[model samples]
Target: MYIKRSIFSDSFIRLLAVFLGGAIGSLARAAIVIPLAINPLISVFLCNITGSVLYIFAARICGKNLKLVKDFAATGFCGGLTTFSTVCKDGAVSIQDGEFLLSFAIFALNLLFCVASIHIIDSLADKFGKASK
Candidate 1:
């Protein structure tokens, strides 16, 4: 006997995975970031840079077959943990507060750090993966 599951069942399960992971990630972010809100830029920077590193590591570790883990950790958690909206809002706030240098610095730092973290983590993962096999 063959049993068939509906398409929506898989999607629903994936969505649930993402939702749970996102919730946890958001909470983790709030715990770290809110305390550091004395300097909003620092909070955003940490979230973004850490999230990029985490996503890269998670993707490398999980590989292609673990769709649930990849979606949960990389897509959902990292997406929730690292926020584009908050970064934009922080930049806007800085501009409104007339901290032009800080604003530009924030933008530049986020861009540079996130890019560098991804590249570095990816390279390390590749090296480690080959050595492991």
Candidate 2:
């Protein structure tokens, strides 16, 4: 006997969810980054911070059973919105330009803010969750 696989298989659906979410997230990032006259590093930093906060919010809101939401929001959207490669490139470029302090500051601040935003959002979500119950 031969088995036929449906087009909307679980894995396929999950992949589609991620792909759609990523496309939207990437477009959103570009929309923000492309128009700003500010430093490229600053734009990327803002995106990273925003993405971190969004990921935490999604994780808390989605909970354990909402795998699609988690995958789309936290994994796909956040991953697309935040550009670690750009951050690394910025740091490298700064270093090459002999701006050692600037490179260090960019790396340090990004790390600090992203981690802090995650904790702050998670804490706020916990508090709100308790208050709502």
Candidate 3:
């Protein structure tokens, strides 16, 4: 039997990657929101969409060998950049305010776009061998 060890297998390195990536992602989100001063709904929409696309591409590119890319980009960066809680909150508030249409729109948009982006990116990656196994 043979064992393989990668730098990313170290718990410390993984933790560091996640921490640094999360910090940067969060800062990036703040930078966009602050400078744009967009409405919460719009901001959340943009963030989730962008994060979804980025996550899909990064995950594919990272593949199996590049655990660092998976940790930093997909897990930490995308996790920090996209706010599911915020989207849920906004939806709930909209519903409470009798804005059912807006709430539905947000919910649908988030789901559909995220799912579609993942599928599209994955297909493209497979076709182009973004991260060949």
Candidate 4:
């Protein structure tokens, strides 16, 4: 029998970093978002956008895997904090249980909403930055 290791865990240290980083990210998310029950769609929208920006910065800072900080920060923290797997699982279940159209619609809705939120946020921020300068 063979056991497959996590992508980050091809080696022991990498695995440890991923676990620790993910724990930190998950904990931070719980701390920040648990206080209020916001709309699920809004929460997902914001989180996905936030996670994407963080990922861009993290990979840049990581620089050829030499910086563990980026990997841990993005993969562990942002990845853990985001709800992508939940979306995938829900979508899959919806489709498998014979609601293929509904599942597809939900998936499309998520993608559309998330992308729109990102655009809105960036556009506003850019405007704000210009105004401040």
lDDT of each: 0.87, 0.89, 0.86, 0.70
Candidate 3 per-residue C-alpha lDDT over 17-80 given as tens digits, one digit per residue, 9 for 90 to 100: 9998899889988887778867867887788889999998887778898988799998999988
Cα TM-score per model: 0.87, 0.89, 0.84, 0.58
Go through the candidates in order and give the C-alpha RMSD of each one to the true structure. 2.2, 2.2, 4.2, 7.8
Error of 4 at 9 (Å): 12
Better of 1 and 2 by TM-score: 2
Look at candidate 4 and tell me the lDDT of residue 101.
86
In candidate 4, what are the lDDT values of residues 1-133, reduced to their tens digit?
1355554355677677788888977776665566648855455555666776676556655668666676588788888777777678767887799998877876787788656765666676667869999
Quote model 4's TM-score: 0.58
List runs of model 3 lying over 4 Å from the truth. Answer: 1-9, 130-133
Task: Highest TM-score: give the candidate number.
Answer: 2
Ranking by lDDT: 2, 1, 3, 4
Q: Score candidate 4 by lDDT.
A: 0.70
List residue ranges in candidate 4 displaced over 4 A: 1-10, 89-106, 109-133
lDDT for each residue of candidate 1 in 1-133, tens digit (9 for 90 to 100): 1234666788899999999889988998898877764676687788898899999988888899899999999998998899888888888998999999988988889999899989988888788879999
Whole-model lDDT for model 2 versus the true structure? Answer: 0.89
RMSD of 2: 2.2
What alpha-carbon RMSD in Å does predicted model 4 have with respect to the real structure?
7.8
Tell me the tens digit of each residue's lDDT in model 2 across 95-114. 99999999999999999999
CA shift of 127, model 4, Å: 19
TM-score of candidate 3 relative to the true fold: 0.84
